[model samples]
Target: MTFLNHRHSSFLRSITQIVTGALLFVAVVSSAKAQDEKPEWKAGSAAVVITPEEPTWMAGYASRDKPAEGKFHDLYAKALVLEDLHGTRMAMITLDLIGVPRSVRENVEQRVEQEYHLAPASLLINASHTHSGPELRSRYLLVKRHDAKWAALADQYANDLEDKLVALIGTAIEKLAPANLFYSHARAGISMNRRLPTPGGVTNSPYPDGPVDQDVPVLIVESPDKELKTVVFGYACHNTVLGLYYYCGDYAGYAQEYLEAEHPGTIAMFMMGCGGDQNPYPRSTKEWAERHGRALANATEAAIIAHRTVVHGPLKSAYDYADLEFAPPASREQLEQDKESTNIYVKLHAETLLDELATSGSINTHYSYPVQVIKLGSEILMIALAGEVVVDYSLELKRRFGNTNVWVAGYSNDVFGYVPSLRVLREGGYEGGGAMLYTSLPGPFTETVEERIYEKIDELVQEVSTR
Candidate 1:
């Protein structure tokens, strides 16, 4: 009886040991499988000098009498390429120029698709809209100055820019490596509404009581080793802090410069926000521009140090064009009358329209405005709107998409002219249609401008979210 009991105890102990060992083995296998299946991010960055080598005519300010004499610093075209775990890629290119010309966008887009197999929806191009950058539109130069030399120079610079941009995109793609992304925001009070309300109408001056967007959205990319690689930040103010004859990136350029200097080996890119009707206070001097840049850089640093939401990804993007109808263009008779106006801009605009009528038989009836949406996992939703977008659009979208981190970027893809909200259009200010005199667009967008834009944006948001 004693021998039988001892044998039973030994057998039970052996069985318990086998069961425990098997359980431990299963747990180890499960943890290894989970780590292998986890998703990761990859990112790359590159920048190239884009400032024209010659004395080129400046954009934005039509009253400038001559080409640029010098530059405060060289302008840049920077590219940031991001790839997700599934190998899907997106490229974002930011320029320190006044605007992204349609030609440049088309040229670079076609090349990137052909060379890198990148989809059209995955490319985002934004311009800083600095008033002191070189004017790249040959037609505008021809109409304004009527000098063939100036037009030729503009054409040459544009062609060179197209080549440089294509090469830069390639470099960024080649450098892609393991990375981590974070999204955070801070506010800076540098921008104010420039359309002041008066008894007569809305004038081009700072309005203290008008609506403004001071939110500075930032995206920080770092290596697996926790070294910062790139910082992309945005502000809703015109990069028009200085308008001197010297070529400069204005506040946007200085902001990027300061950030890169403060953090060596890190690339900093600036995206323009909805600041069509906003301007910096105490502008028009180099010192003011630097001060504003420092302020913005400090705000960006604060965001970096603050709590950040990790940006995860199966990255998704959608892009489409909104058919924005135009109001009736100026009649031939009206153009003839305005041709004799004392204001050079008014006269030049009329003459240009007259030439357009002679060439095309009618002014453009509508514009195919571009609208883009990009989703970084479930945490961040970035909307890039073309043209000089007004603050109302940004404010409204933020309210509508309050559940996610919404970053609205204006002056993207195409910067043909001002894009006014329904309120701005109804108010009939410069951003509404008065600024159209400077662009080839015939007149202010119809009231459906805002509706059409929102319709396209909503469609894109739905598409990206579902995907």
Candidate 2:
């Protein structure tokens, strides 16, 4: 009887031990999963003045804004650093300039990569496309006159800008802690498609029927203490408000200023969307610019108050590049007339093309375009593209893959020139063929521009989805 009782006790003890071990295993797995599920977001921001004090040639549309006599306005350049909790990072530097030359962008990128070990795709540099700013690249085509003074100044400015950006990124990383990201979108109808359809049913007339991305996407950054640190918003409209000589960030800059003012202590970053063929309608004065800025700020405030969608969990990012070539311009004889004309931009570009054609015997074709996509956990996909992208790309992407989870950005990677669709190319307007004279490209993009863009985007999306 004693032996049987002892055996029963031993069996009970073994069963209890087994049960406890199972519970401990489950608890460990659950804890690990919870740790893995933590949302990742780290951010930093810095701003510098890239505006030139002296009068310089402005870029963007051919229209020029005369500078006020002996007066200068403040112009600003800003950098925003975004990274996952694990330290993988990306930096976006927005300049208050007309455009940045490819060489300038590449040099800065190389420096950043060498210094910080940042991937080229992870660093996105963009221009506000402010027509009131100085000309970074020579707009003249025929006479290759180098503004050594301006070039030297620009180089120094870029270097300074890079250092400031790096510092800002570092600060953001250091401040990273428990935070939450919320996204909300609203459409503001201030932007109108500048490319219109002609009476002959031909598209690309300067009449204003082109597609516009009115969706004002807002990303609200909150600290662990539940304070709003920043509001990053994007719109697809050219900031041509107050197009006067003194350097200014234009409507985009005003918008950021207004937002930050309204929400004291909160930073506002404006990511210009696909506004190549879009403009802020009724923009002719500084007051109008302020009004537009207020509208955007109001929209952001509404999103925060009404519907805030918070993003949680780890972040995943992916980037890819594609080379799309442009077809050679018209024959030298055909282009010579334009080249010899007073329009230095056209003349210089024509001569360059002619020289290339003469040397290669055939016009060189194709541009190496890059498309980058970043996914933040299961929510929010940010797609960045090169060039002055028109609104069609943004609209199409949002429509195809509901705007709730996608944010499309332009003026990213490289700003070689305007990137027009096949439809726009066929129509042959400024964004399509007319603007080619402003750049060093041999000619307008080949008809395959649309195909190449679509294919690359598709590949990028697929790659992210699979990952």
Candidate 3:
């Protein structure tokens, strides 16, 4: 990868800002009483800065006309490894970037299983879906024009990222020691439903009254000496506050920064929830991103102070791919007509499918989507679904699970595109079907989308449960 000295004169200023923010964040909360004794759990965490080494094309928003101009803040890939007394272990890696491309996940997964001696199902990877992060794909056939230089930069960045992730997972596990784990949640109204229904149809705009997940779930990990080791938190919203030339992690970055600042030596890991159709309200400005970050941080702070559930060990984990089906492809003549469209994404989408039709004899009708389940004792059940997941999953999964702690994270493993619920698929909006034009996928998922996924979740839940 091309190297640039991004550590400019602003390094000192950035350090000062972090110190100030940490002090402020700490001042905002009263310290909790120390735990009497640590839980019988082993934990470790490690992080690496993944800011693009050089100017490159950024991901998200196809309207941008040029490569990234400069840096707002560096992005990162953080990992947490937890093990129980029974020797069961789980490793989770979180990144401050767009989706985890399938190629990247496949490479990292293979390396992790061979090196770490863990089952393929025990490792989980998530992306923050930050629009301000660097693009990791070598070529985006639909939305981006073919530029060899930009494509090379993206390939180099992706290769470097995979190496970091593989190393980070091992490093975290190597750093493992006795630790405590606790779970709790609070609310933050930073994200609103972006699909507004109108007389015309569901438009992609902020709809305040639509269903949204305001809950900020927090998981605290501390050493036996009562020192905070890591704080894992999640919210259901897209980290798209600033769509500019600079590189940053958006609101998720700010929340982690504030927490780490307030609690020195602590690693704050963010797991994105089902926020496919949600967006940060009053966005497109730095102030709003910071404000939302503060709001989310404050919510986590409140949860940290509230009554908590001690997550016990005997950790159980399961992972598998769900064969999600796409709708039937268009006829050859229809595809030819689509290839002639003025819209590049639409035309290219049709062209790609036409190519697949010629080569594979037909477009792919199903996707090998990733789905995971991890049970912490019999108390918490975590479901990590791939792609940009909508809120209906978090809402309905919780309801169906019947009051146990269910943390459903999106943008995990292989984030190929949007994963809409049956409702959203029926509504037929950007999240529903329109966004498919920007991907190599054949079409929107069929009507059985929600049912098929839930069935798999139930099976995995049974597979990982203790009692």
Please count the clashing residue pairs in each candidate, in the order shown: 0, 10, 0
lDDT at position 156, candidate 1: 96
Model 3 spans with C-alpha error above 4 angstroms: 1-38, 141-143
Instruction: Report RMSD (Å) for each prediction in the order shown.
Output: 5.9, 8.5, 14.8
Distance from true location, Cα of 104 in model 2, Å = 3.3
Q: Rank the candidates by lDDT, best first.
A: 1, 3, 2
Candidate 3 residue-wise lDDT, 343-392, digit = tens: 78789888888999999897889888789998887667889999999999
lDDT of 2 at 145: 62
Per-residue lDDT tens digits for candidate 2, residues 110-209, read 7777876777767777677776676665434114564555455555555565565566555555555555688888877778888766666445324445
Query: Per-prediction TM-score, please?
Result: 0.91, 0.83, 0.91
lDDT of 1 by residue, 330-428 (tens): 899999999999988789888888988999888888899999999999889999999999999999999999899999999999999999999999999
Q: TM-score for candidate 3, please give it.
A: 0.91
CA deviation > 4 Å runs, candidate 1: 1-39
* 2 against 3, candidate with superior TM-score: 3
Number of the predicted model whose TM-score against the real structure is largest: 1
Superposition TM-score, candidate 1 onto the true structure:
0.91
Residue 5 of model 3, lDDT score:
54
Top lDDT prediction, candidate number = 1
Better-scoring candidate (lDDT), 2 or 3: 3
